[model samples]
Target: MADVTPNVSLVATPEAVSFLQNCQLPVQLNAMTGNPAHYDYDAEINTAITNLQGKAKESATLVARLTQDEVRTSPLKHQEASKLAGRLVELAEGTQRLLTSKAKGYMDASSDFMGKTFTPNPQREGYYLRAADWISREAKNGEGNGYKAIREAVTEDPDFAVAIYNTSHRLLGLPKEHAMDFAEKAVKAFAPAALDYIEKSQRLDELAKRYPAFIAQVRSSYFSPFELAKVRTYVEMPS
Candidate 1:
């Protein structure tokens, strides 16, 4: 007296079809135990679950590559991984929103790290501020805030050469007599860290020329690495 009817509507893809075929075998085996009439419906649901599992496995592979450190270090690889990571995070978030319980469990089981990366929160504020400061500095539109931010970054990380360079360069635009001492200090602080100290010294020389008195003071004051090298070169030159 069992109603045995296959539901055809549930078969959507090749994976789904394969899933339903395998699922039906189990239901057909246990037909005499319970719910013989709904075996077809159960088979369809299992088919959908199996198809979802296949898709989840594919996405998980991409997510794994994105969070890997070595992949993020290379410019080309990082760009590609970042895009894939963002997409996977978005997919996880959207799924979580539409199907809270099911998607939540799936995400918890499949990719907890992806879930955390996708969630928006204040932990990312520092990264946003750092990016904004860099953009403003490069655009040369918000010099005051940009310089201030760079200075703060230097305070937090003394070895930050880029921040030191920006701070010193911006300080050069201030009143010559007032900013000279700080600019000299910045140059000294940054000299060892810079890739091209000669170029930096040339730039500072141009700024120092605006105030002859400050130039004299810096020449007589304790010589910075660049200044000492310049002085030694002049001393050795044949006059």
Candidate 2:
């Protein structure tokens, strides 16, 4: 199990509060229908917004933890570190899409004023519930490998790598040219462990100290091997 920071908080921003307010149902819809199975659209949308905000904030904190010295330097933590980080990234990005996208804005507006109840897209609610459960379970267990969805994404999903790289660069607060050059240096320095050639348990910390971009990448990606491979140039294990 990787290092755990159990007090992670999923804070909802004021903007999120206002945005969710715009999505509230009018008084007429508050009454429960005679049917026992009647679904509450207002409750559903509010819950989705609330859950997404909390999860995204928690993911940011966990991603920050994944970049800590202990986790980054410990060979034992590397694989689990990547799995947790990748899943958080997937979760964060999905939350961002559902919360901030223009399509969501349009949809919410229609739903709020135009009498629409359920979203045509079931995947939003589906992923939210599934991911919320998975995260809750993993938070308690500290066994990071249980989330197979992100593991598969980090390995086979190019988009995952792309998103991590792009987001990481910005998160690092680096200029584009400097960020690129630094990533190249990180690729050379961390390639062995990333390729599973040498554990280089201490070496990861040494290199991270030298290359701050490496820390940013790990903070953003937990040093996902696929993201490492996708960093401008591909790196492979030497046979």
* TM-score versus the correct structure, for each prediction: 0.18, 0.24
**What is the Cα-based TM-score of model 1?**
0.18
Give lDDT tens digits, candidate 1, residues 59-82: 334433333434332333324434
Q: What local lDDT score does residue 125 receive in model 1, on the 0 to 100 scale?
A: 51
lDDT of candidate 2 over 37-97, digit per residue (tens): 2212335334543453454345445544444545343343344545655664454344334
lDDT of each: 0.35, 0.35
lDDT (C-alpha) at residue 216 in model 1 = 29
Angstrom error of the Cα, residue 239, model 1: value is 49
**Candidate 2 TM-score, C-alpha based:** 0.24
Clashes of 1: 0
Which candidate leads in lDDT? 2
